[model samples]
Structures are given as C-alpha cells and as structure tokens.
Target: MFRRRPARELSADDLLTTLGRLTAQARAGAELQRARVELAEALQREMLPAALPGVPGVRAAAAYAPARNGLDIGGDWYDGFPLPGGRLAFCIGDVQGHDVEAAAFMGQIRMGLRAVAGGGADPGVVLARANELLLSVDSPLFATCTFLTFDPVAWEVVAARAGHPPGVWATADGRCGIAEENGGAPLGVLPGETYPVTYWRLAPRGAFALLTDGVVEGPSFPIEAGLAEAAKRVRDRAPTGDPADVAAAVMDVAEFTGHTDDAAVVVLCYDRADRDNG
Candidate 1:
C-alpha cells in the first residue's frame, strides 16, 4: 500500500528556489527554439547571392522574406547568373518544409543548379539534372521550381517547371499574363523526370518574373485570387522599367494578403537598351 505524503507548508526560501528552477527551464526551452531559427536564418542569408548580376538590356532584382515563424525557417530561394554569349539564367523554388533540414537541402539543390546551369544546358535539361541530383540525396523532401534561360539578343526565354506556380510575363505594351508552364512532378518525386520546356519572348521593355507560392496563398485567401492580383500588380508596375519596383509590387501582395509562408521573388525588367547597372 502506498502512503500519501502529507503536504507541508513550504518555506519562502524553498518556494523561491522552486520558482527559479522552473523559470530557468522555461527560459532555456525558449532560447533553444530561438537559436534554431537564428541558425537557419543565417544559413539562408549565406546561401543567397550578395547581389544580382547585371545582364545586357535587363535590369534584375530579387527580394526574400522569411516567415521566420515557429521553430524553424522555411525553404524559399532564388538565383541568377550570367551565361556564355550574352545569356542569363534565373530560377525560384520552394522546398517542402520549414526546418533546418529543409534549408540544408535547399543549399544542395542550389549548388546543383549552379553547376549544371553553368554548363549551359538547356533549361529543361538543367532541371532534369537537378531532379537527379535531388534523388541522389534520397531526402524525403520535394521541391517546386521554375527555371528559365534568356537571350537578350534574340529576346527569347526558355523555361521549365517542376510543379511550380506559373510565372508572370508583362509585355512592353502593358499586357501582363501568367506563363502556361509545362508542368512535371516536383523534384525528388520521380527518378528520370523530364520537365518539358515552355518558350516565350519578352520584347525589349517587357518583364519576366517568378514568385514562390507564399506570395499568393494564405489562410482564407484563394491562391487563384492571389495570382490574379499579382498579375494586376505586375501590369501596373512593370512598365516603369525598374526591376526593384516590380519586385516590390509583387512582394506587396504577400504583405497585404496575410500570407504565413516565407516568400521570394525575382524580377527581370528588360531594358529598351543595354545599360550597365552592375
């Protein structure tokens, strides 16, 4: 038989000691969660480019916002680099999580993108290689992405999508529309997945831009409506020929719509003529 211990009135010093121990434990737990978030945020900042490179006849800019919610950071990323023979490449993607593990894989996918794209592979092939690379890692996480290569001389862009949201295109004449992206399974979902390519040309003074899903979707907000609103914002702002403004215009959607996800966007506004903004 177990005997119930009698409850004794606690001395003031004993109560104070018990309270301090509980307080310390609670503080330690909170600090631990904050530390994880800080580390992931640092990793994200380190992975992103210090500055977007300049492309002939195109002014480019990108923006990133972390939900930084909960105990981890999310996996929204974008990249740009100049290719051989006056071509430029850019992409945006979201891996399937909000944890340090997601950010680590995000870095891996990014490196693969840079390496394969640096070889000047076709945009479709670039994503295919990336798919292979991700599968090789054998991580449970999958990612959605849009990859595109542009030639200013020809005013052409070849893009491929891996279950990502279609990008926005704004013509110089003040028309804005979403790209009807040829979709494939998200990376790491299928081995040897071939992402079909889509082609579009942005005439001088037009704009090509990609945004992660976070910009458009949130609780009580339909993604369709968010996308339509983004199109309107781009149309109203793209003609200004300022890539920064265009990026801001898109990011504004996330802010006003109360999205709870991390967001990223890349805006490349084709200039009427090439100028050095590098």
Candidate 2:
C-alpha cells in the first residue's frame, strides 16, 4: 500500500520547482516595498529649502534633524526670504503629524505664508491669512508656527505665533528669557481665532532661538525639562560662535538617547556689524 501511494505522488523535481518560484515572488515583493520606502524618503528631503536667504545685519543659520531611523523625512521646516520693505522674513513651523501627506500639507502652508509675508504683511496678519488659507483649501491640519520680522535700522524684531512653543532669547550677559506672548490656536485647528503680535529689540550680540516641539517633547522628558536642557547647553556654550553650532548642541542633547521626532531650530545671533568685513 505504501509503495502504491508513493507512485501516485508528484515528483521531487516538481515540488522543488514550486517552492523556488514561491520564494522568488516573496523576494520580489520585499524589493518593491524597499524601493517605495526609498522613493518616499527622497521626496521628503527634496522638500527642504536649499539655503537660507541673506539678512542685513544678521548672521543666521538653521538646522533640521529627522528621526534617527524611519521612512518619514519630517514635517518641520524653516524659511528665510526678503520682505517688500527691505526687511527680512523668517519663519519656523511644524505640522501636527509626520508622513508624506503631512509634509505635502506643510509645503502648501509654507508657500501660502510666503505669499502673504512677501506682501509686507505683519506677523499677525500673516498668521490670520495662513489660517484662512488652510481652511479654505480644505487642507485641514493642525500646525504650530511663528513668523518674525527683523529691521536692521531699528535693531528690532517683531514676532507672532500660533500655538507654537515660546522662543528663547538670551541677553549679552548670559541671561536667557523665553519669549512668551498671547497667541491664537494652531492653524487648521479653529478658524476665526486671532493671534496677537509681540515686539522685542535685539541688543548688539543678542541671541534668539526658535525651535519646534520635536526638541521638547520626548519619552523620558517633558517640554519644560527639555527646554531646561537647551538653556543649560546655551549657558555652558556661552556665545555660541554660529547659529549652526547652537542648533547642533541642542540636537546633541536631545539625541543623546535618540531622536524622538524631527527637531528643527533657527538661531539668530545679532552682532554689531557684519563679520564679512572682519
């Protein structure tokens, strides 16, 4: 009986051929998934601006850190461009989520802000228009952001925010203060909300820090604790030589353990005169 059953079974060659084809198909699927991930990452990197625009009487630099390991590039971004009145426009913002769609939405919001800001709109007006655009476009997504203007002649900087964390400002004597002002809800959150504008004068050699929540929100730490860490680094590394350096120091602290989210920061150090002459 056993001999008869064996004779009725398929040949070994046929079984091996079937197994080989199945393995090949599984490998092809894996390769395709990998290709998709790579494509997504490349697209994300392309979203960031190539270089920050030049601003009179200011040496500014910015840096962004993506997650330690993932397919997500990030939703955080910074932009520097000239305003209509010879003033400079600088902005930083972060979308609520991290994904391809979120990044696309971020690009749309950024372009809209630029269009409004380019028209010499104040920070408050810029935020309001941005909110309206988000709602009208039906691209409803929450975002925290700050818009700022720097006037070299007046040595002044005006800022406005929408549910973004307060920026950091440090005096010449090593004293640092958080820039807290009344703000409206984040964009695409609730329409018809108003964001108040705030003003501050930049002392010669003053340092200002604008950061995204990715730097503060973490697993083992709260926002306050993370802010404290940034302060300590700033104090210890007093008079950070450049904006990029300060950004790196902050990232070093947050990434000491690992990157939780996309960390982006803009550091502006006001010097009495341009370094190019020196």
Best by TM-score, which number? 1
Number of backbone-clashing residue pairs for each candidate, in the order shown? 0, 0
Tens-digit per-residue lDDT, 53-102, candidate 1: 76667878998887835665889999888888888889899999887788
Tens digits of lDDT, candidate 2, 133-239: 89897875778899898887677899999989877777557887668778889988787878899988776776777888787667776777777677666554437
What are the models' TM-scores?
A: 0.91, 0.83
Q: What is the Å distance of residue 135 in model 1 from its true position?
A: 1.2
In model 2, which runs have C-alpha deviations exceeding 4 angstroms? Answer: 1-36, 236-240, 256-258, 275-278
Candidate 1: where is the Cα deviation over 4 Å? 1-15, 68-71, 272-278
| Candidate 1 TM-score versus the reference | 0.91
